[model samples]
Target: MDFTSLSLAYPWEQLPYALFAIILAFTIHEFAHAYVAYKFGDPTAYQQGRVTLNPVAHLDLFGFILIILAGIGWAKPVPVNRYYFKNPRLAGVLVSLAGPLSNLLLAFLCFPLLLLADQFGLGYKGIIELLFMIIKINIVLFIFNLIPLPPLDGYRIIEDLVSNRTRAKMSQYEQYGIFIFLLIFLIPPLNKLLLGPLFQYLVPAIYRALDTFWSLFL
Candidate 1:
């Protein structure tokens, strides 16, 4: 899973821009979560002042490094007390879903500029690099966050859809969530056994979809 086999540049020359887009997109995602949570009556994130685009407000150091290494990255999680909401389970799921949805929205919003560059063939090297990083990062962010593991957005989405009994049962696993996540990252057998097959399909699907969208207006 090193950069060498990913066929990406060392990202040496694009390091600054890559890092900036990663930080900016990640911060925006988290900020959207906090903002939506606040709107739905959870003041926890607001009190902590997480409802802003300032990367410093939402940056997680280890998470940032993972972005540099092409690992699925994360931002500081915004706190939300679902109890404060009119419909706790539903609002909670919405807040959880907001982060990745924000990233997709950003990709689509930035789509036109990339297409413009592609259309005119203006500095193809730079534009293609920008498009690649932005689109791939967004796709990875969307898929990684959607994994139905504890403490991830998909868990909440599942909670919202399933019975209260099931939600309560799953809640017990939250304490070990990060450990489970690390195991998936560090244990070769599990990564090879589970993640490898999943990504074999997702990677190409994401790229094809991105290409389809680009061809529409480029």
Candidate 2:
């Protein structure tokens, strides 16, 4: 509750800010999908009254807890009925990609904030810490969601790209999806294997970009 009061180290310090980033990212991510789906004529989310930005309506208790413990978890998915779409396959792709793409946009937005802070000589540790979290969370959400795993947005996008036969076969894995997902996430080798690029490259690039952008603007 006391965000600034929280103390965390160089690596772990990003946790609190990550918490806020995830909440904001997922809220907007899901909201955008819902809004677009509604605009495109799917009323399921609207009918369920999920068009609001109040994250309480979207947060998943288990997922929220996982963020504190495991560091990655998801809010409740915004309900979408693809049958309501005029072009189900294409619509599904956009809807699925929307979540992670929103996070990327968030990361981009953070750059300007960092620059603004720097301009005022306000690149305090707290602000840097917050920007770090923003970068990490956005990248994690982008790469993690882009994984072609079941029920994740990335998988839907993949499904749109693959053959119909594969899609049909893959549907069977849906029921067991989350367990498989967590198993992979918790498996150290597999987890690192997945995040190697994210930590080694993507994150550093983001930090450098923000720093450079700030230098230019400030």
Candidate 3:
């Protein structure tokens, strides 16, 4: 999920592809959240137009810039009212998971196009690059959103799973969640310790599985 390489190694010409990928990935991620929340009886996001696929509805200015510059950022979070759900805990977890899962779905959908581009040596190199960029950004979004920390889908899932008392304790420290998240990425040792294995192993494994599955068809 580390995009440091994209920023440093890729030329300025590729920025448009990266930006397109980011908009699509982030839009789908947030839309999944809003749609799921709406399905589970929360109209909050829907009423606010957060359920739309339009990137403008989901993109946050600062977050979008950070994603382009640093490769780590977020979209406008879909608003949800858990009180509207009959089973708040379960619904909450599902709603929280929707965003990351949507990104994974996007990555899965893009894999075959990427494979075809490679297999046929597509003359339009830009198209191939765009597909690759889309896949990479979506996969990164999937993995990064699932890290169990505040302001992330994983943390929301955890918050739903825990008891009320534990959740209350978590709430007390919610203000520091963003700081902690930044520390994990900003501190090299911490980033290596927490996300190294995930990016190194899990991401590759996912691609391998996708390749194996798609190879049968292509």
Best by TM-score: 3
Residue 110 CA displacement from its true place in model 2, Å = 1.8
Task: Assess candidate 2 and give its TM-score to the true structure.
Answer: 0.83
51-141: candidate 1 lDDT, tens digit per residue: 8888999999987887577455667888888889999877878898999888877776666677777778875568767776776667667
2 or 3, which is superior by lDDT? 3
Per-residue lDDT tens digits for candidate 2, residues 90-161, read 888888887788887888778777667666767565786677567667866777788777778888898887
- Model 1 CA deviation exceeding 4 Å by range: 1-10, 70-72
Tell me how candidate 1 scores on lDDT: 0.78
lDDT of 2: 0.76
Per-candidate RMSD vs. true structure?
3.7, 3.9, 3.8
Using all chains and alpha carbons, the TM-scores for the candidates as numbered come to 0.85, 0.83, 0.90
Q: Give me the displacement of residue 182 in model 2, in angstroms.
A: 2.1
| TM-score preference between candidates 1 and 2, better one | 1
Clashing pairs in 2: none
RMSD of 2: 3.9
Per-residue lDDT over 123-180 for candidate 3, one digit per residue giving the tens place of the 0 to 100 score: 3768888987888778878888888888899999999999999999999999899799
Clashing pairs in 1: none
